[model samples]
Target: MASRGFIELLRLADMARARKNGRQGGQESDWQGIVFEIGGQRLVAPMGEVSEVLTMPEYTSMPLVQPWMLGIANIRGRLLPLTDLSQFLHVPSRLSQMSQRKVIVIDHDSVFSGILVDQVLGIEHFNRSQYRSEAIDSKSPFAPYNHGKFFKDEQDWFVFMPSLLAQDSRYIDAAI
Candidate 1:
């Protein structure tokens, strides 16, 4: 009878450890991302792609460029082109207070651009298995660069790939 009780206690302890690990993302297959609002759509940028988030910096408006191309801003001695992602995506702005807007900077490879977003909701972790690559909304302007979507909190978080945006001809050619 003592051996039986000891075995039961061991099982309970194992269960507790497993529960703790699951809560901490072990065996959770977690997918972490930087969540931000762009063009009124909530998006999750791949954690590795986003270099930094910053306040909307003052930039020098460039001449004869697409209206979405806000211009260039000097950041730490590096010139970063500021792009209004909502406008560039041809989506109406969420109309948030300008003070609340932020720039999601991407410095992948040689592509260094500051993407303006309505809001930065910080990092979030979702179950990797819940990410659906085929369920991305086709109507979203970001759909082209988006790779997948995560259903969280009853809403969809589209995965935005700014590295792909850097290679897009429409995004690269900023002439009026």
Candidate 2:
């Protein structure tokens, strides 16, 4: 009877260890990203692409610049051109000066620019298997720059590719 009880205890311990390992493995398989809102749409971007997030700063207007080009702002002594991301993508923007907004600074290659967004939702962790490489819709203004889409909490979060946007010719040419 004593030997049987010891064997049962060992089996229970093994089962507990398996459960703990399974939970940790699930977490390790998840992908992390930053979530933000732009043009009244929820979006996510890989954490690696974002350099920093800052409050909207006063900027100087440039003549003959595209309407999307808000102006130039001196951030930390660095002159960064601020652009209204929604306008650049041709999407209708619900953003207004009165509403609190933020600028997501993206630095890729030798290019650096600040993109104005509605507000940041927060950092989110998603399961890697949940990412789907499909267009959210045929009319999505951001279809070209969308890397993929992920569904979480019953909401579809489209993944925006900042690097691709930075490399686009239209984005590079700010002069009108």
**lDDT at 170, model 1:** 94
Clash pairs of candidate 2?
none
Per-prediction tally of clashes: 0, 0
Q: In model 2, what lDDT does residue 92 have?
A: 73
> What clash pairs does model 1 have?
none
Reference-based lDDT, each prediction: 0.78, 0.77
Tens-digit lDDT track for model 2 on 47-117?
77877777788889999999999899987688999998988987776776714887878889988998998
My TM-score estimates for the predictions, one after another, are 0.79, 0.79
**Candidate 2 wrongly placed segments (more than 4 Å):** 1-29
The residue-level lDDT of candidate 2 at 100 comes to 84
- In model 2, state the lDDT of residue 170: 97
Q: How many clashing residue pairs are found in candidate 2?
A: 0
- lDDT comparing candidate 2 with the true structure: 0.77
